[model samples]
Target: MSPVVIPARIKKILIIKPSAFGDIIHSLPFLNAVKSTFPNARIDWVVAHGLHTFLEGHPMIDKLWVIKKDQWKKIGYLKSTLNEIFGLVKGLGKEKYDIAFDLSGILRSGLITLASKAYMKIGFEESDEGSPFFYTHKIKGGMDNHAIDRYLKLAGFIGCDTSSVNYPFAPFDNHSDICNILPPNYVVISPSAGKPANQWPAEKYGELASMLPLPSVVISSGADAAIAERVVKFSQGKALSIAGKTTLKGLMPIIKGARFFITNDTGPMHLAAALEVPVVAVFGPANPVRTGPYGSIHRVIQKKLPCSPCYAWQPCSHWRCMNELTVREVFDVVKEMTET
Candidate 1:
């Protein structure tokens, strides 16, 4: 489809991408590109509640339309969820945006694009759940491309210069209060994955930590504390668990200061990659080509199997893709990275 012509002066803009840490990290370059393109325009974002904290106080964005999306899933909260959605639609319509980009390309995001009532509604033709029908303009965001590249394609489509790919995180300090409890020098291990299928065994992570040159620190949400604790318990005193101790913003300094990072295909792995921290990312059923660490300074470890990259959020009875990958196999890469 042919693109809509952007107005000569775009006074206000809306960007729709919410939730999940890795995907949000992928969108940072697009945010940077658009900010450079429209320095004078007011740019607002529709971000989910918890993830909003990560983008909170972002320098490039003017206003954040925080939504209670996580709460929307609870049947008990249906009334409140509907009320919040109503407020969101009415408040967004009031913005009178010149352009709105639906980066997420989903049913919920499509509704957000429609609610904005922007002069130019842009999204990917490949967006899921019939979301493309809602957009006035559609770009071909190929699924094969890295998410960073895919998001930048939208920036290029919107007349923003995409020559420089950069992750402009909001200003954060180098010191974390939780750092006080951490070892002076440690390798950070993110042993838990959002999907069980994407995870390597937590016990194997502990075994790997035992072999590392420095002590290891485990990070996770309170929900995944069991996995984090399992890693610590099996580390033979080579690792410490700080799960549920730090906020999202607090995580930056910890990742930034780590000697190196070891993780499954999860959000903090991307954060580590963005911070230029060397990462040894263990992949299971997910396609690393599309969602792996973005830079050259990363090593991805996955068992070579035809059934791999299945993206099975729910693990089958025997998941050899991750189950077959031994701690020694992962340690070889970690050792090589540390040596070099």
Candidate 2:
């Protein structure tokens, strides 16, 4: 394969990274590199439904094409799903993009890349579900590298300066109404994880929250309301449950003003890290090296069990990785972070 050379007259580009909030956050630095290199380019992103709000008013992106991914997955909505897919392809075909990058290396994203009708399509060489077949250019995105670094490698392949990693998010306005309800100098605790194996017990989170120097504000999506309620209940009135209340945009200011954050390995964890809030993340099944808090200031608490970081699809029978991590251990780390 010949090296990817950015055309001097490059004008339009599309980035296809559809869903999963944390992965989208990981792609920001790559977006920054491309936008920095081609300051005048009209960069568009194909984001998934519900998750597009994070990048809705981002400075670097010119357009955000949202796809209804969840809606399309419903077996009952076959007709609408087909219509959406075909309509999206037809619309993308009309855009005439100069280049398209498939950062989300999956079959669906690969199809979107092909549909864009871009002259140059770039994707990972090791992309699963035969996603590489549609790529005009394939870059070796290593498996073991941190997600942010792996994405930057693609920027380097396209001759962008990858030396410095910058997350160029627009400043979020303070949700003063939300802030007014909470105690000053509060700590945000995000106890939900995508995988059950990655989650620390809600009772454990509550215990940790109760021990913190500041008041704890527990956040949760509508789907995780039960878990959030359990955390608040277990806190014995020490923590406040604001579950199902804030939108993605609303959550930022809450995190921004937070003294520090405590979370399971999840999307909000990445959000807190992006906001430069001090974070104490608890890791279990997943490898923190690849997807943990990125910066040096944040702290990660995980057990050193040999079977830890298993990355399992099913919940572990014992779940010792998270179960064994004591509330005292997490509380101690939070205390240390506050002092610093």
Candidate 3:
């Protein structure tokens, strides 16, 4: 595909990447690349409602178009959903964007790209749900590459420097309340994942936390409170449960100040990596090479089963990949990490 030329007049730009915290973090380097190349351009992002808090005051982005994707998906919200959709299209059409990038690569994001009425629309050639059809320009974003690298390929297509991966997140004031409760020099553990198959057992996490040298602070959202509680319970008071207490913005400081982090394949795992905290990530059905913690300092623990890296959404009958990983194995990695 031919490279996209940003005209001299190009000013306002729209980036459509709506949900999932980890994917949003992966897209930050791309945002950095775009902003670095076109410093004067007004960069806007369409982010999902709950996740928009992270980007609310972002320095690189001029506007954040929050979409209530979860609320719209509810069966009872038919009328409201239609109104919201039409309103979004109408509002976006008025922006007169010079360029729009569909980084999410889903049907909804494709529609959002089309609705932007931008002079140039760009997206991945292999985007799912025929989303590539909406793009005026398409770049080859490899499936095998890390999500961060795949996103950088899009920036490269737009003549942005992708050589250096940087996350240009705006500075955040530390949530002193969170800090006050957390023990000094503690390890943060996020033992829950979006998919059940990707999660290592909560009891196993408890076992690992109990053996750690430092006090373990178990973090969890409202949805994952049960999992966090189980980890705390099984730890026999070794780990403290801080579930449903902090916001996404508040989580940065907690992770940034962490001695190290331990988690399953989850969003907070990515958060820890972005914060430059050393991570000990446990992998199961998901492929660690593609989506695991990024950076040289982090460690990934996974069993090398013949059917490993299965990338399955549903639970397998045996689930030998996660079942086979022992708490001792994870503790050993943590011990090694802390020593250095």
Residues 1-340, candidate 2: write the lDDT tens digits. 3447677678999999997888988899999999988999999999998989888888899899998898877899899889989999998999999999999899999999999999999999999999999998898888888889888988888789988877777556777577789997788999988888888899999888777777899998989989998999888788998888988878988988888889999998988888899889999889988899889989999999999779975567888888788999988888887788
Q: Which portions of model 2 show Cα errors greater than 4 Å?
A: 1-3
User: lDDT, candidate 1, residue 148?
Assistant: 92
Greater-lDDT candidate between 2 and 3: 3
Predictions in order: lDDT:
0.90, 0.88, 0.90
The worst-scoring run of ten residues by lDDT in candidate 3 lies at 1-10
Q: How accurate is candidate 1 locally (lDDT)?
A: 0.90
Q: Give lDDT tens digits, candidate 3, residues 273-330.
A: 9889999999999998889998999999999899988888777999998988999999
Listed per model in order, the count of residue pairs whose N, CA or C atoms clash below 3 Å is 0, 0, 0
Worst 10 residues of 1 by lDDT: 1-10
Best by lDDT: 1
C-alpha RMSD for every candidate: 1.3, 1.6, 1.2
Q: Which regions of candidate 1 are displaced past 4 Å?
A: 1-8
Candidate 1, residue 37: lDDT: 85
lDDT of 1 by residue, 1-340 (tens): 3333555488998999986889989999999998898888999999988999999889999999999888988999999999999999999999999889999999999989999999889899999999998998899989999899988988888788888789999777689788888889989999998898898889999888888889999999999999999998889989999899988889999999898999999999999999999999999999988999999999999889988778899888899998889999999998898889
Error of 1 at 7 (Å): 4.4
